[model samples]
Target: MDRVKGKTAIVTGGATGLGFAIARRLEQEGAKVIITDVDVTRGKEAAGEIGGLFKQQDVASENQWISLIEQVRGEFGKLDILVNNAGISGPVQNADPESTSTDDWERIHKVNGLGVFLGCKHAIDLMRQSGGGSIINMSSIAALVATPFITAYGSSKAGVAQFTRSVALYCAQSGSKIRCNSVHPGQIRTEMHDSLLDETAELMGASRDDVENDFKSRIPMGYFGEPVEIANMVLFLASDEARYITGGKFIVDGGMELGG
Candidate 1:
């Protein structure tokens, strides 16, 4: 149960869905977790529920990232794990490449792409001071496949995957024990997923159930994934059990990326 005992972790967007599950899992396994989110109320509630701490943060802000890392350093004396899980899918109307506005594209990339980059960058600095640690960036199946409907999100996530590899190799070359990897989840049953379904249904003029069923049919597993499933993977990566693993892209996508 103490897989990450005495470790210190920071999970972004931990107020809900996948982030909350990941934070809870890490804390349950004995890590001292700090949950961060733009949603201050829910963030505090979530932290309270998990017996962790809460910090309000807008991940896209470099200043916030700097402050967060410093706070972690001050409170915990060291940071061991970081889950860059905060992101946005963008408005469904302008998500397509052809219709997406420059501002829309930049907004998605700001949070999904730049946020992870900053997290890895600052976390590396802190982690190096205290030996080394693990950095888990949450990507998505959209990153690995064609996502014409969510061009910005897919592109940003793709950037995350490639960047993770670069961070891992860079750390390894620099003789830093820090490990970096990306986790790509497919059709997880989260609020984000629900929003996607609702939007898709509206776009297609179909019932939500119909849209959901259609999506389910494409997944080889024939169902959406659970948050705990992804959390378990993060736990393993966060633990010393995966000490040898670095620069890897772990896909937890119920075989949906294998093609329908």
Candidate 2:
């Protein structure tokens, strides 16, 4: 208990799925958490249940990001953890570069790419003032591999990975106590996965069961990871125990990315 006692955290898109899991785990470990999501209903409920605060936020907007940080300072006095987890997988249409419309690319990049950049850039100021904090960016295995069907998604996540490394280096060079890292989760069982599976099935003209099995078979563990499993990694990074770790890419993929 109290693994992150007295810490203050802001988890963008914390209303559901992996974001909710991260928020809940942070709360359980004694962080005073503020969960933000565009989904007001669910975000408020989740925050209330965990004894935290909820705010409607659109991470894609620079204006919203500015206001959120200011509000966090006014309410919490100091920010300790910033989890940039808000993102979209982009439309799964024909997703190859040619089939991917400019609209799809722009929309996904705004949230998944630029939003993360804004988060890291702004949060670093507050974290430095707090005498250093952790920045956990939600990257994905998609960033490390090619998935033409998820062209926009993979590209945005790649930006995240590189951004994470750049932030970590900046902190280290400046002799700051701040640490930055990225978490790459693969095939986690969540609404997002369900949607991805459904889309893949439709795209491939395969049964949903067949699509799911194909995904599972790609994992050495042959199963989808639970939300909490990914959350635990965030918890560790948020804790002081990971003081020595930074600029790291922690892949939680059940060896799916491993070569045979």
Candidate 3:
């Protein structure tokens, strides 16, 4: 864990949920961390609790990315890790391809797809100067399996997977020490889950308990994964421990992706 001591990292959407968990893990591993998110209140609270810096950033905004990297460079001097974790599920119940509007699709793509692209695009420059870095793009199980209900969500994640691979190869071909990888997670209990639970229950015409049970049953582990578990995987990849790993997709879904 001390391998990351004195290293600097940035976790996007680090205010809460999986992002916050990753930030805390990176800090615990001795990395000087900065977390960015649009949620000012929660972002500041999480940063204060973790003893890291928090900045307001809308991942979908291309213009802000330049400023963001500059800010990090000025304060931290170098960037060793970049976690592209800020994403939205996109208009929940209406996420079906046919049912989804152009606006919804564009918005989701902006954050989930373009955001990761821009993050890596800017990060590589700073990282190359520092000799090397790791980029972890947060994908979802939806990227691999077809989730009939949330079309936009699935499409955006699919884009993330490919983008991660493309960047990895680019870095390799360029002879840069930087690495890029994607982490696909299954359902984890978070505020985002709370927002969808009732609606999802209604959509499936099942009780909330039944929906929760159904999700758990899908995982061979018989339980939902903790965000920290995913965080641990990311921490390893961001550290020298995974120096030889790149362009790989790590699925932390507890066997949910086994069947279909």
Candidate 4:
């Protein structure tokens, strides 16, 4: 539990769901936590709950990322962890790969792909100057499998996976202690997944129950996972327990990959 004690961390989209859980876990483990999100009201409340700081941020913007890194370094005196958890599932109606528009692609990549790029691009500088740190990027199982439904989502996540590896190699070659890794989660029951189920049901003209069952059937465990499961994996990566880990694709999917 004290694995991350005295560390400083930032969790994007930490106003709720998995991000909030990750933030809470780190803070509980003795880290200085800062939760960032565009949702001002909920983000502030969530940060207050854990006695952490809240910053309004749109992750896709380079300027905001610069400001965030500066602010965190200014207030905390150093940087240690950066969890690029802010992302979007793309437009629900555009779930069909064939019908997905360029607009939807832009929407998904801007946040899910470019946002992470910016996070790492900026965070690495700060981390390098302050003795290096951990960077955890939230990818998804969709990137590992054949996902025709959420094309944009899967593509963006795939970029994240590769980007993570590239960053890790750069740091190692440059003689820095900074570690970059991607976390691939499958069907975690967060607000994002819940909304995805609803959207799929509406698109298919089926009940939510039917859609949920179909989705769960693919999992070898025959069940969806909890947000905390993903959070725990992130925590492990953020801690010294995973010091030897870098550029690794950590999948916390309840054996779903096995089913495939």
lDDT of 3 at 9: 96
Lowest summed lDDT across 10 adjacent residues in model 4 is found at 89-98
Return the top candidate by lDDT.
Answer: 1
Candidate 3, poorest ten consecutive residues by summed lDDT: 89-98
Q: Of the candidates shown, which would achieve the greatest TM-score relative to the real structure?
A: 1
| Model 1 misplaced stretches (Cα beyond 4 Å) | none
Stronger candidate by lDDT (2 vs 3):
2
Tens digit of lDDT per residue, candidate 4, span 1-260?
A: 68899999999999998899999989988889999999999999999999999999999999999999999888887888999999999767856778999988898999999999999999988888879889999999988987668889999999999999999999989977999999999999989899999999999999999999999999988899988888889989999888889999999887888877
lDDT of 1 by residue, 1-260 (tens): 89999999999999999999999999999999999999999999999999999999999999999999999999999999999999999988767879999999999999999999889988898999989999999999999989777899999999999999999999989988999999999999999999999999999999999999999998998899999999999999999999999999999988988993
Q: Candidate 4 deviates by what RMSD?
A: 1.0
Instruction: Give the Å shift of residue 72 in candidate 2.
Output: 0.9
lDDT of each: 0.94, 0.92, 0.91, 0.92
lDDT of 4 at 76: 80
Expressed as tens digits, the lDDT of each residue in 1-260 for candidate 3 is 68688899999999999999999999998999999999999999999999999989998787889999999889888999999999998656777867888988888898999999999998899999888999999999999999777798899999999999999999999988999999999878888876677788987788999888877887888888899999999999999999999999999988889965
For all candidates, what are the clash counts?
A: 0, 0, 0, 0
Candidate 3 at residue 134, lDDT?
95
